[model samples]
Target: MQGDTKLKVGILTFHRTTNYGAVLQTYALQKTILDLGYDVKVIDYNNEEIYSYCDYRVLYGKLPLKTRVGKIIRYSHNKKIAKTFNKFRNKWIDLSVECNTNAQLQSVEDGYDAIICGSDQVWNPLAIHFDFDAFLLSGVKGKRISYAASAGNITLWEKYLKKYWICLHRFDSISVRESEMIQPVENLSEKKVRLVLDPTLLLNKKEWEKLEEPLGNEIEKDNYILVYYLGKNRALTDTVKKLQKQTGLPVVLLGRQIEGIKSISVPAGPSQFLSLFHHAKFVITSSFHGTVFSILYHKPFLVFGNGNYNSRMNTLLSALKLQSRMIDNESANLERINKVVDWGQVDSLHKALKEKSINFLIEALR
Candidate 1:
């Protein structure tokens, strides 16, 4: 417990999420804030919709009747995987008292000195949980700030512009993760929005390394290409095959199980996810976090873009000067994938971004 003198901070983000990026980013932001001498807690605001996304039972019920059997089979196979993810959350995250509704969030408002809203796509309308004003610290008193909050897309829908514009005004300061989103947010809120690094990047590579406890000997010793495709890009399947042929290595697909590939049916928790990235000879992925860890670990990786959904990845690669690492459907070719990334230069850029982002957090909190 913190003494009375230390400021009590409540953070609002996707803390209960099972996703590797969401969990680690939440941890990074909390750790960073604690390092700054404040007592921090991730506001335990559990959105039923977001939580349902991870629950196979809820998911199976939503699927078509014809697909129910397959869904059940998949869910049964992933029970342990889900348990691993839940254990990570229960073990590592420091959560505040549970707040289910806006009223509940406001009820606990008096306990905090200030409230922080992000380090993720907490402003994204597509994220049903954040679409409402709760993550904006609505009804809360005192300082309200967003730290590296992401809109997650290049543009916001016209319908939400006015609503977001009004809600964003509550923030004393605004910092967005995507560089392309700064002006759009500024135009909406008429507030100066700063571009900052993702929370995971704010904490250096070594800091993340400490979180990775070995997942037994299940991890293969042989060098292999790690495939983590979160999008429905069939072309990526071919690309993975080509990479396997060229590299003369086996392919290990993380996340969902693929028929032809050596897919790990288990859902990889945060630590296991890190282990996969750390041990991989190379990575080919469509997920934002997949690309992030590849860079964090200084691994040579290729990103498969998902059209407009690829905007966040584009912004990250552009900012770090690693655009060549990305390959889209239009530009898909062996030549691009075979190209090399200069990790030495990338590391320098990451350091600069890390410092700038951390400085923004410190200043915003002060």
Candidate 2:
């Protein structure tokens, strides 16, 4: 605590999203700051623009009856998934009063000693639609800092370069999740940008295990290859099948079910997500967070790159000297899957980076 009263810190990020990585990173960052003895609150400002694409109410507008019917069915299924995500947020995240507009967020600006925006793709213009005000902490009176903030795998358009330059300059200190992001961000703001670990990496495997919920009895009984993919890649199914055949293990697919694959679909929230990763025999994934958890748990895993987003995963694997773990469509061979990882070396590298990341946070907060 700073002085007699605890220092209040407010975090601004994509906390309300249904994505597992988005929500888990938010929780990790909040928990880390809270552990440091500062009062931390996630500013629960809803971005209507981001929600507009997913809102079921949009179906109510004029459209073909058949199209509307299909959307409504999908919306009903999505509502259940959203409910589990909401339950996690309500139980774990300490959120500020709901702020639906800029004015509402501004009202609470003076309540914090510092406002942090980070550990996710908060700076990606495409994700946030170039909304510079909120995530950049525009009207806040507190000290502004960014921790492990990601711009994702995007090239800045000529028109938006000036916007990025102006808003990024608002931060008192800047740190990013990927090293490739550091030079570009520094060039834009003309300020030193530190390379930092994602907040999820700040917590070790044991700390993450405390949040895991048990799997169903049947799932717990089997030794399976856990496949967690974000994109619809036909190759992913074939790769998982190959891994299954190679390891003689059944497949447990997370998220949407594949049409031809014989796999079990697990409806998981953040907590259950951790449990699934922790128990997997061999992990196969195309997500950054999935790769993250696999490394954290020291699981034998293979990662498939997701287009431009591959840089984030590559940077991480390279740092730990585990680049051999990433496989492509052509390189997805049995030998690659069977390759042994130097867990001892990887953990040592991760520990050094985690300490550096924590030190960045400590100095930024000071």
Candidate 3:
């Protein structure tokens, strides 16, 4: 099946968030479907509950005095980051008319041939502030499918098995991001759940490099270590410091300001995030997408397991036969840092998975 202007597809995922992975995955999924020659647009479904977390002002009245003060100080910094994210959304992601309520979302379902809700933790209630109806496509009359849809940890889904069973039955096809989710999702829905790569991995290195922007005059000329961690782990911090001292290279921190780490803070959006990982001498992170980008760029990197949320990262690395790249304990062996990754073997495995994932999408759309 070639590109069909009449075959309208709408993507439902966490596209409005300030996080790099959320926005970039949305872009990758939308771009991939659009490239297949179908009319595609992200179902710009904005939940106020989800929006409040992104906008600091929403919690101003509810927080304690001291916490509120801290929020005030970070407000401007977060605003700048949010602005960059908004710019990227407008420029790259083709979005449908804004839909805030479930009724609003249901109202637009008839417009799409198939609604794809996926490539992110959309099924995770906490991630979406318990907005199940929208993400589950409750009242959708058209075909429904999920591509790499993750629920973070599979244990979270056990409590909501009944809900999963009902909602999942509405899906024409189902696929999950983490391998652990396959059994649970399949058991709940009684549908054969396919384990697929994250949307970021769906696009190869050259495809992603096209979206990468330069780091500008800010440490672009310097060979630096790129550090991107979502959590505040002392072990990761210590490892970064040790690596910096051992390698004699400057460190560039990607997200918020971390205490005790003397690193350059670059207010980077999705594109700059790509460039950082692309040009880094080595990458150190605790984020799943951070690890994905590191692998995509073929960068030498180490990913710290993020407590219970380590399953996703574990699945990916294990699949690629790069288990040594993940550090699960506080004491990391820096010897693995010098260990080279066999890209030829890794790429061969990755290509097979990528082709299988793309085939799933193609067949589902047909």
- Cα lDDT tens digits, model 3, 192-211, are 89988898888889998888
| Best candidate, TM-score | 3
Off by over 4 Å in 3: 1-5, 54-69
Q: Per-residue lDDT of 196-217 in model 1, one digit per residue for the tens?
A: 8878877777888888866445
Candidate 2 lDDT over 279-316, as tens digits, reads 89888899999999999998888898788888889889
- Give me the runs in candidate 1 sitting further than 4 Å from their true place: 1-5, 54-66, 129-131, 216-218, 264-266, 330-338
* TM-score, cand. 3 vs. native: 0.95
**Which candidate gets the maximum lDDT versus the true structure?**
3
Model 2 residue runs over 4 Å out of place are 1-5, 52-74
Model 3 residue 345 lDDT score:
93
Error of 1 at 107 (Å): 1.6
Model 3: lDDT of residue 228: 96
Scanning candidate 1 in windows of ten residues, the lowest lDDT window is 257-266
Best of the two (1, 2) by lDDT: 2
